[model samples]
Target: MSVEIRRVQSKKEKKSFIKFAWKVYRKDSELKKYWVPPVVADYMKTLDKEKYPLYDHADIALFTAWKNGRIAGTIAAVENRRHNEIHKDKTGFWGFFECINDQDVANALFDSASQWLKAKGLDAMRGPVSPSMNDQCGMLVKGFDSSPVFLMLYNPPYYNNLVTNAGHKIGQELLAWYIDQDLIDIKRLSRIAQHVMKREQLSIRTINMKDFDNEAAKIRDIYNRSWEKNWGFVPMTDKEFDFMAKSMKQVAKEHFIYFVEDKEGRPIGFSLTLPDMNIPLKHVNGNPFTPWGLLKFWWYGRNISAFRTIVMGVLPEYRNKGIDSILNAQISEYGGKHGLYSSEMSWVLKSNEAMSKLAKVIGGIPYKEYVIYEKEL
Candidate 1:
């Protein structure tokens, strides 16, 4: 039967559009063990006209693919003004994509997304990027062994072939590393960090929750400035930064957020790590409101054995100063003392050699990879 492509319209259609992935991966034994069903509420936030401030700066369309009256795939196309404004390019993004290993369905989803973006007057379409790369972007190309970390993506290996066959070429790659306890040499790290800190007047400290607003403002400055030259770079608006801060506060561990300040007390670098909540969320099987599910979530929070480093940045002036190593040492020390057995530093741009080298220096081994694909519209 031919595949049917349709834009999501009604509330009922939206629900099925978001839930299609669960049905596609449900019976796969490999995914069944670790899949934390994607949260419907979270997906809703992306489409909420008022909640997502990004809507003010971008155009988006959500589509689902149907075969034999069943949803076989889904995708979203986004045109981010901030991204285009910063990069000075008319590139649109497509994300939230999924499908069974069916070429016709994949082609239908891609064609719909491409046509949607083309109608928006975009010059090129690149994805699978969320409204922003800061959100979950890229299709999983490697590492199928475990569940994805919180806010990370997971997909079957066949996704790569499906995307490539649909006239998409590799746009970029993101790397995820597994940091096991045995790989880290604490003694060497401490000695190296101590020497580096003493010689360079480097100081690392946890973010001050009491001054969170002020601290976040500083982080925004560094983040926008540090990555200003990156490909597809976009300066997140103040509203967006505040929105992120509010969300992070709910699950953020203070000690896991560290900043490096110079002798003059200017914030030069920062790192933010999040507990691997998926370890516990998986037990809930994607239902958080159920009584037993809530209990399991709380229990898992207390017993989490791993964390994911979500953000790490340094000002342009501080690059190559070994500041990252010092900050990482502090983070590792805190994690070790607090029962964290492993950490994942992830989504590093494949072309970012400096950061990639730093990951290796910290005993991180590349285990998972995600790719962004693009085609001229």
Candidate 2:
């Protein structure tokens, strides 16, 4: 039977696209315990053009692959004008990709998106980024033995085969490192932390909950500018970044959030690590509207035993100035003292050699890997 690819035109088709991952994960027994289901409402918000600020600069189309009238796979094709303007490349992105093992189904889904991009004058296609590089991206090709941390991507091991068979090759590889509390060198952390602060005239503090809106604005200034040179980078508009800050605040932990400022008291660098809320979220099965599920989430938020490092960076001028080490040390010491057992420092790009080497030097094990696939359209 041939797979039929069609544009997602109706609300019912869109619903199927959002919920298709649940079907895929449930069908695989191996993923039962390891997969953490995202809140359905969040997915809906991201897909909503009126809500997701990225749509302000880019155009997107959603497609679904149907076989015998059942949803077989889904993908979103995007043409981000801002990304091309900054990078000087005519490229499109295919993301929110979910598919079964069938090569025909995968090819049909890929072609559906590829053709859309090609029509837009994009010469090369890349991604698994729903809308842009700032959001959840990449396909899991390694580390099926554990659950993903924070907003990282996860898929069955066979996803690699699907993308490869569809004529896509690796565009870039990203990694996640597992760090155990027992291996954290607190004394070393404290020593370097103090010395760096003194030498660089820097002061460290957590986000003031009362002043988070202002703090987030400051971080955005650094975040957008610092990462401008990164591959696939796209600066998030203020509204987009503010929306993300609002979301993170819901589960933000004080100790796990650190911001560094110069002696003159201007923001310069920051690091954010959230509790591994997925540990309890896996039990929700993607349904968070229930009273029991909401209660369970609150309980896990307080008793989380590990953290997932989400974002960390220093201003370009502050780079290689020991700010990175200070942030890493502060995170490790705080987690260790708070009874946390482990953390996943993840999605570090393969091209980021400094961070990759820093992870290893700090007793991190490269436990997982992910990649974005690319092909000329």
Candidate 3:
């Protein structure tokens, strides 16, 4: 059967594009474990020409693959100004990708994205980045044992084959580690960390929520400096950072967000963790706007069992000085005190062996894995 690819046009078509995953994964028991039903209204808002800030500086196209007049797959093509400005490259991104095991459908989606990017004069296309890599930007290649943690991508195993068969090569790989509370070597690390701290005059402390702006500024500086050498790294704009900070204000635990400062009070490193909202989000099937879903979320949020270590970074000069162990020890200490049992230190790059090894040293299990694929266009 031939698959026809067309840009999402009407409201109904947009709905079909966003909700196609539900139909594709409906009968698959494995897909149901951590499936978060995409909130159609909220997703559409992101693509709106008037509302989304990215729309102001980017060209976007949403395409749905149709077979026999029904949506079979979907993908979104974006040429983002922010990405271009940071990388100084005319590269485009393909995101929100989903499809059946059929090569025709995958080809249809890829062809549409390529044509759209070419029209924009982009030199190359790289993604599975739904809008941006700062968000979900990968396909699962290994470690598919459990449902994805909060904000991580989950897909069928065949998705990787489909992507590679479509000619996409490995662009980058992100790692996810599961930390079991029962097996942590916190006492050993704590003793070592104490010595390291005393020798280096380094101390770990929680960020002052009252002085969040000052703290955020320090984080911004450290993030830009620490991750500047990473592949596809972009210095987040002020608006982006502020937007994230505002969102974090609601769910961020004061103790879970920590900073390591030098003897002279310079911010040397930081780690940010959030209660794994996926537990409750899984119950709601991904939507939390309804009164019942909101109630369940509120109820479950108060008693979250797992936390996600979303961001952790140390300055270049501070690396390999046991600063990471100090940060991890602080997180484990706080988790023990707060009744949080387990944590997920995730989306680490596959090439980031140092961090991955450190995660294991702190008793984090390699549980989940996500992959990013690319194709030259």
Candidate 4:
């Protein structure tokens, strides 16, 4: 029973790759509880080059490893042009990776993905970034005790061995801080926030859903400016940003997204906390649209008591003026007001000291850790 790696070429093969994770998780019931199944159709859109706009700026190859006629693993190799253009680094990525506990299976999959990127002239390979860093990136290296909030990934504890066995070293660590709403010192943070707000004449507001396009334009401005210098960052194209904004609207609550502005009405910072959809999504089997699935989705959704702060950033010049504290305090206050008990401000880069300090200041626990691995291609 030798394992073999094959390229995903035909449509049927693509389908096989999309569905292979279930097989990997099916073998581990413990993993299954933490692993939320993605909607079959949603994954299809990600793999379909003509459909996913990301392919517009990225070159990619998909591969699967098989053993005894069963799918043992899957991976995607990607070369994002925008990343190289922005960072001036010839680095590629491997993501959407899933495999059995066997290091051999993991090696085969990595070998295939690496070879493909090497051929593309990429100097190094790094990731668990399914395609690009803007999306779901990083492999869960800690916090295996609980299920990941929606859009955050979950993997078995042993998966760490697969990367090291494949000769990859940790390239970076990403943190997901668990904030117990009841535990944060909001009163203290609030005092700081008020001081900063009054001194800077800063005011906070939520997205204007009535004029969403206009609102999105403001967010786009802050996002591009705030995160331009962050590691592995590439600003999303106008088309990409608009597409994301439109899609997010489907699940958005106006109160959950915030904007902080100066007295002159310049948007200086933003934070987006998506309600933890995983609670409901888990029951819906990943697709929220099937008749019964939608019913289950809404039913479970009403009981959602948490959120994940997907992204939060401030313009570089405004970094030390308590903007981060304001964001944390506001999020804590909002969650408590709404009767939410828990939230996660996640995927924070380990190198980001400001965020680490803010997490500490707000009583956030680094409960989940995700990592990016790298190797010379």
Candidate 5:
């Protein structure tokens, strides 16, 4: 069967592009078990060129593949000038990718993305980045037994084969580690944390929600500086940082966020965790506005017992000083008192030995793996 790839133009076409993911996942009951529907309205905003911060420095083209008049796949080809400027590489990105288990359809989608990117003078293409690294940006290659935690992604196992057959290579591997709160030795962790703090002359404090903007500013600074050395790191501008911070604030728990400070009270590192809202989000089925959606959200929201450590960073100078251990101990300590009984420290690059070690130190079991693929355009 021939697959026809067309650039999405009209608002109706864009809606179809977003809704196509439901069709893809729901086609199989087993695949639906682990898939959480992202809020449709949120994606609508992202599709709007004027509303999304990424558009300020990026160009994106959405495309859909049709087979026998039905949508078979969707993809977005992106040229992020900001990423290129920082990384000094002529790389384009493909994201918001979803397709049926058809290599021809997947290949057509990839061809559309590659042609669009190549037309713009980009030399390479890399992603699955539903937009950017700051967001969900990987293809799940392992651990398909359960649902992904909050902000993570789940996909059909055949996605790996589809990408590889499309001529993409594994550019990087991302790992997710599961930590059992019940198994944590709080006393031992606290002892090590205390020693690290005393030896480093550092103090830990919770984010002050009352001073939300100011706190976010401090965190944005630490975030850019701390993660700058990581592979594929793209510095978030103040506008982009503020945009993300606004969304996160709605779901953020003050106590679940922490900052490490020096004796002088200057912040050096931070950790941000949120309740595994995917648990309830799954119940809402992607829309939390409808009457049924609201009821489901409210009921399931109360039972959320897991947390996902979304981002944790320590300044380069302070990394080996054990600030990460202090932050981890605090999470296990406070989370136990509250209702969070388990956590996932995720997307740690396979090459990041320090973080991988920290996850294991906290008794984290490596569970899920995701891959970012690349192709020479």
Candidate 6:
């Protein structure tokens, strides 16, 4: 029997595309435990052209593979004009991928997305990024024993075979490191941090919620400047940055968000960590707006003990100056004081030697690994 690929054309089809994940996970009891149900309303925003700013600068097509009168897999093909303009590479991306344990279904889904990209004159297809690198990206190739932290991607272990069998090669590997509170020598860390801060004439401060717009702009500037040379990094537009800032602020802890500055008061770097909302989100079961869902959310939310350090960066001029140490030490002190001892430092690129080394120095163990795949179209 041949697999039929159909372009999603209606709201019903879109709903099916998103709901297919439940079916895929239902068959794999082990994988289901680690899967977090994304709030349905929030996930739908990605599909709304007017709602998601990415649609303004990208061309995206959603497709579903059908066999035996049922949906077997789904994929979204994206041609991000902004990414191509910045990188000068004609690359497309496939994301929102979900498939059962059928290679033929996966192949059909990949082939359909590839053809869509090829039609747009793209030279290569790379990703599992829902839209781009700044958002949810990567496929879980390792560490399936625990649930993912907030904003990270996860898939069944077999996803590796499904992708490679469909002709995609590993393009890059991203890491998630876990630092246990007990392993950290806080006193030593503070001593080193103080010495570095004094020598560098740097000061650290928490984010000022009252002056959020101004603070967010500063962080965005540091983020864009610091990550400009990184692999797969595309400068975030003001709107996109603002959108992300708003989402993160909902769960952000003032104590965990820090800005590093020179004595002259010019911001040089920042770190943004949030309590792991996924812990409560898993309890909501994808609907957080309903009365029952809201009640369940509040009940589970109070016990959120996990944290994910989502973004941290330093300006190029500030690098190699131990600014990172100051940031790490501050996070540790604050987290310990608040009874949030451990956290996940995630999605660090394999090519980012400085950050990876810093994580290891702080007793961070590389527990989970994710990979992005690529193939010539």
**Candidates in order: C-alpha RMSD to true structure:** 1.4, 1.3, 2.0, 1.3, 0.9, 1.0
Clash totals in order: 0, 0, 1, 0, 0, 0
Taking the tens digit of each residue's C-alpha lDDT, what string does model 5 give over 216-276? 9999999999999889989898988998899999889988999999999999999999998
Candidate 3 is scored at a TM of 0.93
lDDT score, candidate 2, position 233: 82
Candidate 4 lDDT tens digits, 122-207: 98999899878878899898889899897889888898999988999999999999989888887898899899999999998888
- Ordered by lDDT, highest first, the candidates read 5, 6, 4, 2, 1, 3
Local accuracy by lDDT, each model: 0.85, 0.86, 0.82, 0.87, 0.91, 0.90
User: Mind giving the per-residue lDDT tens digits that candidate 3 earns over 106-173?
Assistant: 98899999999988888788888877766667888787767777777778888888888889888888
Provide the TM-score for each candidate, comma-separated.
0.96, 0.97, 0.93, 0.97, 0.98, 0.98
Superior by TM-score: candidate 3 or candidate 6? 6
Q: What TM-score should be assigned to candidate 5?
A: 0.98
C-alpha lDDT of residue 319 in model 1? 82
Q: Write the per-residue lDDT of candidate 1 for residues 1-377, one digit (tens) a residue.
A: 99998888887877778888888688798877756777677678777657887888887888998899988999999988878877778899998888999999999998998888888889798988876786788888888888899889888888889999999999888899899866788778888889888888978899999898999898899888888887766777898888888878877888989998888888899988988888877777667668998898898778777889987888988888788888889988877777778999987888999889988888999999888888999
Which has the greatest lDDT? 5
lDDT tens readout by residue for model 2, 1-377: 88998898676767778899988898889986688887777888888888888888889899988887788898999999989998999999999988877889999988989899999999999989876898889988889998898788789888899899889999999999999989978788778889999999999888888898998898888889888888888888998899999999988988888899998998899988988877777777677669998787777665888888878868999988888788888888777777889999987997889999888877899999999988997
Native-to-model Cα distance after best TM-score fit, residue 110 in candidate 5, in Å = 0.3
Give the worst 10-residue stretch by lDDT in candidate 5. Answer: 334-343
